[model samples]
Target: MVLDLLVVNPNSSRSMSDEIARSVAAVDAFRAFAFKTTYMTGPEGAPPQIDGEETSHQSCDACLPLLKDPESEYFYKRYDGILIGCFSDHPLVEALTCLTDAPPVVGLLNSSLSFVSLFPSGPSSVITSNKEWVEILDASVEKKFLTGEARARGLWKGTVSSNLQVLELHSEENFGKIVERIRRENVERLGSKYVILGCAGFSGLQYKLKKIFPEVIFVDPIILGFQTLLSSATFLKCQNV
Candidate 1:
């Protein structure tokens, strides 16, 4: 039987979900596996976008019930691993972890942080949607990825924001602004060698950004999360076999 992975976007925006699917499809096309995917979005009660602590809390309350429901299709056992598609260190990732029966769960932030570490001379930074995420994620990376030695190494720089809402990223006109932010803030101001795309809406724009900044590496955390979760899912399947 083919293994299945579930991706949950903890917001009500279908456009964001579709963007994620498109990016995943691009990655999937190049590398097909005995794996399938199910993309889910936050229910009507959830906000259209997660901007800060309040929206994040609302998302948790709205989506958590569906995830925890034994009768729902999203109940954890159905999939081998679960990817919380939000680009932050979402509350859902930790909430799901509390369940003993839940499969391996990974978030985009967690996966991207880990990936950036592999390139030690990184001077890496995250370019996210809003100012709130800059504060939240900068502290998160420090607590998690930037430890004693890594802290001294300066492998991970910090996070910067474009001050744009997540859904706005879909606009064709806004792409230029995003590139400019990465150029002005992440690359030049911070001298970031590796720039991590820190929002789910920022998916698929990596190619465009790469062309603009040929020297700087633009890391799409969405793709990284999928690869990370799928690897765990595959390993678990093999263990059972």
Candidate 2:
């Protein structure tokens, strides 16, 4: 049976969606999964955080109708799973799962953390562009079942910076080089086993990083989330009989 994996980007940026596709393509585990991506309108192509909780709630609300419109033709009837590719776990995911006939919905953060737990003892750090998102990532880690394990392994570190736009300018090879340098420094000092790219825009960097640090496991939330939902759907189908 074929598994259709829909990755919903809660922003209108096509570049981010394209980056996710490339990252997903690099993973051999998803060869059998039919992958698709959709961009949401209303939000200013980026989810708000420092703008306050009310703004964040409103932005999410604006994306709801787009997410819930089942007959919108963008809906994939054959899709076996859905993945929300935003950094934080958007409420729209839970809302969509409850309202639509869509398959199991997986959020990027949750699935990435779950995947990270499978790694051996060592610290794990998240490399992100927006420093403001560090809080949300921390909260996610706090709520994970592997929190104890993470603490026990002393493999938890979170890093963020205000260099968000650096990703948009692909011509700036120095930006990527700087990021790689930071990753190398962090892994060396902390001896981290896993590194999670915190933003969907950073998805394409996984393969390059893997080549540089072959010993370090790189966790791309979009890929991990898609795989998690796909696996869950397969298991559910078997159990249903």
Number of colliding residue pairs in model 1: 0
Evaluate model 1: give its TM-score: 0.84
What lDDT tens digits, residue by residue, belong to model 1 across residues 1-241?
A: 9969888888999999999888667654334348879988999899999998789888988998998888999877687899998887689988999988889999898898788777877588989998888888888888776656557886677888987999998799898888888888899888899999999899999998888899988888888889999888776665565
Q: Compute the lDDT of residue 28 as modeled in candidate 1.
A: 45
TM-score of each: 0.84, 0.68
After superposing candidate 1, which stretches have Cα over 4 Å from the reference?
A: 1-33
Which candidate wins on TM-score? 1
Q: After superposition, which runs of candidate 2 have C-alpha atoms over 4 Å from their true positions?
A: 1-59, 74-79, 98-102, 144-146, 166-171, 239-241
| Positional deviation of residue 150's Cα in model 2 after best superposition, in angstroms | 1.7
Q: What local lDDT score does residue 196 receive in model 1, on the 0 to 100 scale?
A: 90
Backbone clashes counted, model 2: 2
